[model samples]
Target chain A: MRKIKDLGEFGLLRELGLFGQKLPEGWIGPGDDCAIAPKSGGNLAITTDLLIEDIHFRLSTTGPRDLGWKAAAVNLSDLASMGARPLALTVGAALPKNLPFEWAEEFYKGLRECADRFDCVLAGGDTSSAEKICLSVTALGDMEGRSPLLRSGARENDDLWLSGEPGESAAGLLLLEKGLSGGKALEKCLRRHLCPEPRVELGLLLAERRLANSAIDVSDGVLADAGHISERSGLKVLVEAGKIPMSRELCACAAKSGADPFELALGGGEDYELLFTAPPKNREAILEIGKGLGLGVALVGKVEKGSGVSLLGEDGREMEPKRSGWSHF
Target chain B: MRKIKDLGEFGLLRELGLFGQKLPEGWIGPGDDCAIAPKSGGNLAITTDLLIEDIHFRLSTTGPRDLGWKAAAVNLSDLASMGARPLALTVGAALPKNLPFEWAEEFYKGLRECADRFDCVLAGGDTSSAEKICLSVTALGDMEGRSPLLRSGARENDDLWLSGEPGESAAGLLLLEKGLSGGKALEKCLRRHLCPEPRVELGLLLAERRLANSAIDVSDGVLADAGHISERSGLKVLVEAGKIPMSRELCACAAKSGADPFELALGGGEDYELLFTAPPKNREAILEIGKGLGLGVALVGKVEKGSGVSLLGEDGREMEPKRSGWSHF
Candidate 1:
């Protein structure tokens, strides 16, 4: 009879996972970015994200459209990591009665924009009134005959590749928190924070071509996501902090604001970038695919015969990393 | 630009459904119990329900196990009405930091029980801390090649039927609110409110055998659900007050307490009973099936020409029913 506060989010998940096994046929239980299930002999990937006010966002700063985009984006990121073809999405919103109808309309517009951008359909969901805004988006996708990339498939010598910018979203959050408005520099960071683009095309290419051995989306920072791959694959992940991808805008803003760029890239969360592992044989092809898709691909780290994650600085020295992710407890 | 409060829940849905209709292959949008989608040429029924504290239930009255049960049951009922085989479920929860650990464990236990009872798998979900306890459950089901019974399929002159005891759950809620405990008379009612059994078997039987023309579970009372059928099918539905089957226990309790049993049957929500329409030729077969399943079956109404729902008193006079259900504004 332990309390939830004592157990923390991860502890509770571990406890819940004890019962998550014993999945039915056509279904694989929890432990991945999304749950993969066979529907009528075809595989479908499903993922869900819970966005809460104050914990994940504040109404004062978050607009209606951005709130909706981030909600769908977070779940879509999980879908992207699985290399699943987007199909349908369902949104359950618990909002206050005083919330404007126009706000909901704008929210749907954003949600629909993200869905339509990836050619996904917005399906059905339930709505209710609550004290604070709470949104839960469930995104469903088709595997398109290709096996989904999982967090557990990395080999001992796999090269870890990252797609898209890391830490820019967090840097944007820092800027907003400091009440710094204006400048083209700040707008890019703000967009990263407010609306993220899930790397669906890159994930599909990785899975379809069998390039990536393992995959995950950067939601709770790169270090945390890499750690998930390490824990699940039973391998050590060593990330070269200097090699972590950061947009030029993010670098300039970080330097100007007196924040360490490497630290921000290592520990800033909610970038929605794809962090995946591929064997050396696929390196050239992976780069070609990334370029073809117009996404930046960086070989930031490698998997080894060990456990947990370690970050190495440009000087080949390890620095104490900031704890990644927000603990709900 | 209408405000959400001004538009009400139905209007917002109408707006959302504007986009919902543009679904991908093998998928039908909103305006029904669940969204029907094709996966590998077979249809999957997807439905979601949002349960919020104080709005859907109270922490003071509901134990965590019951909370989980209701959350799963409500969504399962939607799946049941769609005549889908329960496959997997996803739950997204928003909770307070100080919530008890025992409560969460108990909640999972209850969720597992319901899933196991129906041979459904417990998939993964996302959890976060919020201002109040809120749960969103998405239920997925396999329809097994049979055309699902939609709410809009009722033919004119169809015989409407009901399974199980109506108003029992609401009666139970009344008992709990009035602080009435420890009586056999109240035990049945309380159990109905606290733990509702989704009529999966009956719903499956109706769909598999192609007996039911239209189906919906009684969640927002029988009248409101009937309205859904009428609105979708564009046919007049007449429900006789006397035919709405109530248990003998309910009759005795209602008479003793001077409560209107008929009103309770029509307006009391969360009954989780299957209310469906079948042709006259299928009535005998339906009763046989109900008898085999050990469930009560009664012909309670009829669908005919015209529109909207009309309730008849025992004397054959029409009565204006009280509009029940939460209007999310």
Candidate 2:
């Protein structure tokens, strides 16, 4: 890929323009000062996230396409966590002086792919020069008269669940570290790590049906993400170690690498899966929604009256995890 | 100042909790997974901007407080140009590993002051480590039943106008570069440059009343900013150079420094003023609104039948300005 500097400023924008196409619902997309979308009621959900080079991803291991995908995914995940329908996004990119044009083009291509898949429009954004690459995306969504599912809404006895398998991304990272080529399934895992899919549709379904009491995206690993809900809701959470879903391929890969699947499941970051809590009565409904959406749903544990998180091991012993998840600071 | 690293991840958020003050109606201020605000008929005005160290501002000249203020102001300015009312904002700051904690606290203090002034709330944001300082802010606002006032809305014969004086920032920059210090009047010019107040209320009023034919913020200098409206609106803008407002202090400082005041007025940036165009019929209404707000309004030009921007000098001769203004690339 060409460096971003080769594209200059206007050139980079022209490159971005190619990827930003028409939206699914005739929504005006990127290139405008800001995007406009119709909301069910009168409220709009907004969220922003920043991805710094080296800090968020390494150029050597992650491609520009993956970087772009992840940048949008992180912000979209935030919107999804709120149970808002993704509508539009604006990106703020700070490119290094020596960046190549092709790199930027590929980056936007990846971002466009994600936007198309989710039926969202690429809205306006700002671009500037920096010492290193930094991408900040702000996503806008429609709430549609539903109360946003917040991290502070989980009640005691609420069943905790995740949208998909937890440890695939971590397992992929381990394989990459071991100098293993991501062959087929391994590539899929690596892609999952680098370019996570934001559970937008599932989140909308959950909100539409009023099934989820609380929700958060798992960018900072399961333990840390769950910890966020626990801290916000003033409740304790207990995870059944054996019940946490793990992909068969991921388990095999973890075993081969002599890594603990449980540890990765607890502390690995960048999963981007929706971790949510719902009442016991809503279990079947949530399961049906997940099945209809083709999204994996795992019954991980339950919310309790206390504070902090506890792990119940296979031997029926409670243990505190060695560490929480990734901390940005 | 305590170093940000000392606060860790959640600790930093805990620190942010101290600034969780209430906001105007319909604003769900920061702290949740995402921010939500009421929009006019369900449409939102959203924008995101990033300020990188050295690239956007120098720490030596700009204080932490002003840095915080300007960071929010830039994005707020974008929303203002769209005629949106300030709602809530989320900040993402990447601090250098060595930054002290007190700096962060003071930064937030300044940010809080500005947010309060604008009736905005400090929503949740992210903090991380970087080699140099970088701040990214995303602002969301409500349009309140009006179509966004875009740069593409100008038409021929429309009168171009601006709020307040121009070139203050440029004059201040010159003074700072020359190490000139300490006159009360000079200090005002410097403060204007350092902590620009976005014309949010004026923009909102103009949009709500449908008074502006086109609008843009004076961020990249009048010529360049006007050039955007010209290009987007496909209208020729003939700016009357002698009519552009200039503060007496700026004029005197420029004269003392043997600099051309016209050049400064044309090419100086970061003024954070509103540059807009309106129909001749709406001129009286706009002037009344300006008077009601106690703000200065100057009619500087008229839209023409063609494209591109031209300036009429003091001698009634058209002249191309030497500087086009600041370019981020």
Candidate 3:
């Protein structure tokens, strides 16, 4: 018999998508960062994320504050992918009865801090008892009359752009798993893994300037998310591994741990950076916008007339990946 | 030394409320059924509910289809409490890896059925792996330029009205716990427990006519919910135990189980009925509206200028409750 493990997370999501297709006019269903629902005069973009203890985080390596911050940031990153302005968020938590009240206070403190930093309000939520800690954060944003940046809008010949560095978060996780944490570089990687920063400003700016044709958050690795754009847009995404940007911390951590940086960069998940496709003509403007926000923008690849994603090595040859990305199953 | 269990669910919620007070203009935060966010043209009401396996329901008693339906219905009931018209819903679920694919298909079928029946759309969601099944359903509704019916709006001398009987679901739960299920009465209670119908129609009518001064859904028992109204409105709620409606199915189940029917009627939960307050002068109009809708509306209580909730017995003497309601902690 086919089980959830056999179908896998992506397969299960694909099957679930069939049940939500008949949405209302101007409404976008599953498959994007946030679902779009047209309200009063504008569109409301919403996204939800579920995080389970041990599956997503371990208390030994993660503090309550960081856990809460990451939970809210991940959902905000979804809104950012849609170029939606932050508005509000609701958090539903299932906490173990034996958990200390101080842990909850610290968690909410961190969650509120993140929402406040992003100019979003803490809305409402539900709390219940559970044997394990479970969190569900739902974030709502406003489109402000602009069309949402969907994954299915990447045109052929569009340049693939990524904000910030990838692989640092995965490298940090490896370090934590190994119980090795010290030095400035390792500390930076650990921080990245614990508390990811959502590119909300760049997302809103891109939408305001109409810069990008397609966008997605780096929750499922750059290659896997690029595959999403390919499947939705019916185009091929060719990513140049040599051109993928890497942080110094990630490189140091990889060298110390005897791991390949490219593998982590291409296959690791939960970076919360924005990956987008834009017309080649807007490269300079996009670069300038990134500079204005003090963020780095890397041109990694391009869209082509085909299907699936391909990783080209420095030798201009396709490289087979050891692992594509993290799968829940 | 204080743990979540010591604080209890309500106490924890009260503490959480402090973190959400400084909201934007025209926005309501954590104290209502759904947080109210002023959108482009009107207000949007959003509420989220979390259901954990064993904590909220046991897999031995609940089928996958019923679990999905109940999850959606509970969130919709919260929206109904605000008198908001249902718009869209997002579901976040964490399922064990060993679960069969057919279970998911059945679950989504029931979830879609309930959402479709209420004119709501399934927009987007997240799914992950967990040790036990955990479901988080977030529902959104539109106020359509009308003021929301708030729990804090009950005025002195207002009549407290309840739609539908309140004890059937709890009685049904008791029967299931006792492994006793059969006959028409027990079957009816079981259905009520499995597939609860939200008071959407009655809520809309009351909001449309401005007939309700305050409103709340009966998820945490009638007395506890009335206590919420009293605390929020800074008034007193007085309920006549004899006037509280009791379903024949609930009575039969309670009698068979050797449980007190009045205790279940006043302090049991998960009924999804609307407990609202209206002016004494609007009693006839409210009764006519209920008759037109083919729904039974019973006047069982009153709001007075005092504090807290008080339950009066058949002889007009205050009755002390043995247990107020379900407490997560």
Candidate 4:
């Protein structure tokens, strides 16, 4: 057997790949954020995420409260991707000794508030002191007997949809980087960046209604998330650049920063919007849901027979953007 | 309200404690490593722990494999405390870019080996880059309809038992710190420190047989863990110092290091042995289970109608140690 040292991280992961040869029925192991236990009779969805200081957030702009909220929100986003209803959350934080204890309290307050809003319990967590602050959060959800929305389920010609505006958080981040001195547009973007809400209800609605064939959260950007769906489903995602929903606030923030609003909407990350695929027949019903829920749900693209992701201009011309999305690795 | 800074981290936690009064049935809101959702038909126990570089372990001494094993082991120890059967694990690691990829692979390999040994699934986890290597693992288990053993369940006159030697890990750490130059004795202590095995089977037996009233894993040494039971159960734990089980190897290590073996057994942490309380009448049943499992189970003390923990020296004199056990914060 080859030693893991020679294989590298990804390579070793590939070799250790879920130990698929031994998995039980309904067990979806390691590759996904949330693993489904088939033996549970299909009632659980669990997901986890890590957020480190500097890498995940800049202390200059984010305080403990925002940090706490974002920590829970991101993992909740992963649950949403699985079309899971939040039930409880477990948090783990490593703080520096000099950190104001009050700051940690503020962070918990934010986490509590988010959990409350989601009707989830802030069940348990471990806290310790470290050289720098880091957070790990796990969100557990009830599948309610519904099959999860997998990234690899899109059928040919399935319409791509967005639960809300994209790239707002990224735009907000740019504003934060520029100094939080902008107008309402920048403030809105900043809030979006600081506390991007996950589309839990929308995800639940999709799963319950059996509307979405494939789904993922737009944490890494629309194009990048779409890539996961494309690669997993073995189909091409033809994104309509003009069709991606954008708030006037996002546009104004982009304008002030001299950045392209469309590009921000397409390639920027951390919006926590639901990016999903549904059969074209369900478009009307999905749009009705958007109206009923008072949340924007727009058709932004379609799944094609080919593979990978391609963008189309309003004029129906294929265009290539500068980058796909943010990558932690 | 006073600022959190005024409250300090501990006060802040106390203020934010559990959020239990607000939780619904089947919800165990915080305060424990694994929170039980009583509604899961009483089948689940969930727990998480965070380990950071320099604080939890020195990267210079601990290779990635041991780091991974310890990360999983510590959380598993928590599950053992609850008498929950290991089911699945979700891990989140923040790695530095400069970290050798091979190290990460070795870490996963160790994680895989441990999970496999325990019949638990390494279901899923997230990986990201950070300034230092940090690991967070969440262990999910099924309690199998057996009520969880709480740290607060001990009653007056309940017999306290230790599954194995206490402070072996702590002694091992001392040896490691002193440099493992002694003979097999030092090597044994070092191994105990680096790879302390969790008493999962014994915990399961106790829970299943109703042998223990309150149980906890000795991660922070017998005194500290007993203190948890003492405080929670609102009773005094009278530990008989001479009764604490210690190996000949530990005595040798202590002689060389000039440390008291009894003190090391009492105050050293990370033994990962079970410290539990049981009725005196169940001694025969407990002994039988121990014999069946071929594991050591020795009565170390008794629970009394008081508060806090007090140690009686070999000569029956009360002794107060300078510290309880290891504390991360």
Model 3 ranges with Cα > 4 A deviation: A17-20, A318-323, B17-20, B318-323
Best candidate according to DockQ:
3
Q: Write model 1 residue lDDT over A120-222, tens digit each, in one string.
A: 8778798888878899999988887888899999999999999988888888898878777677877898899999999999998899999999999998889
Stretches of candidate 4 exceeding 4 Å from the true structure: A1-22, A39-42, A320-323, B1-12, B18-22, B317-323
* Deviation from native of the Cα of residue A24 in model 4, angstroms: 3.0
Quality of model 2 by C-alpha lDDT: 0.75
Query: Just chain B of model 2: what TM-score?
Result: 0.86
TM-score of each: 0.96, 0.86, 0.97, 0.94
Interface C-alpha RMSD after superposing true interface residues, each candidate, one decimal: 2.0, 16.2, 1.2, 4.2
lDDT of 1 at A1: 45
Candidate 2, residues A1-329: lDDT per residue as tens digits? 35333443223334433124434352323222123333435345666677888877778788988887888888788778878877667677777656665576578778867876776666545566778887877777777676677787899999999989888898888877786764566776777888899988888888888999988888778988888788878999888888988887677767777888878877888788999999999989988988898888989999999999888898988888665665454
lDDT of each: 0.85, 0.75, 0.89, 0.81
**Per-residue lDDT tens digits of candidate 1, residues B45-117?**
9888898888888888888888788788888889899999888789998877788877888888888788878
* Error in Å for residue B288 of model 3: 2.4
Please tell me which predicted candidate would have the highest TM-score against the true structure. Answer: 3
User: Distance (Å) between predicted and true CA of B324, model 2?
Assistant: 0.9
Task: Please provide, for model 2 over B273-294, each residue's C-alpha lDDT reduced to its tens digit, 9 standing for 90 to 100.
Answer: 9999999999899999999999
Where does candidate 1 clash, by residue pair? A26-A38, A101-B3, A101-B4, B26-B38
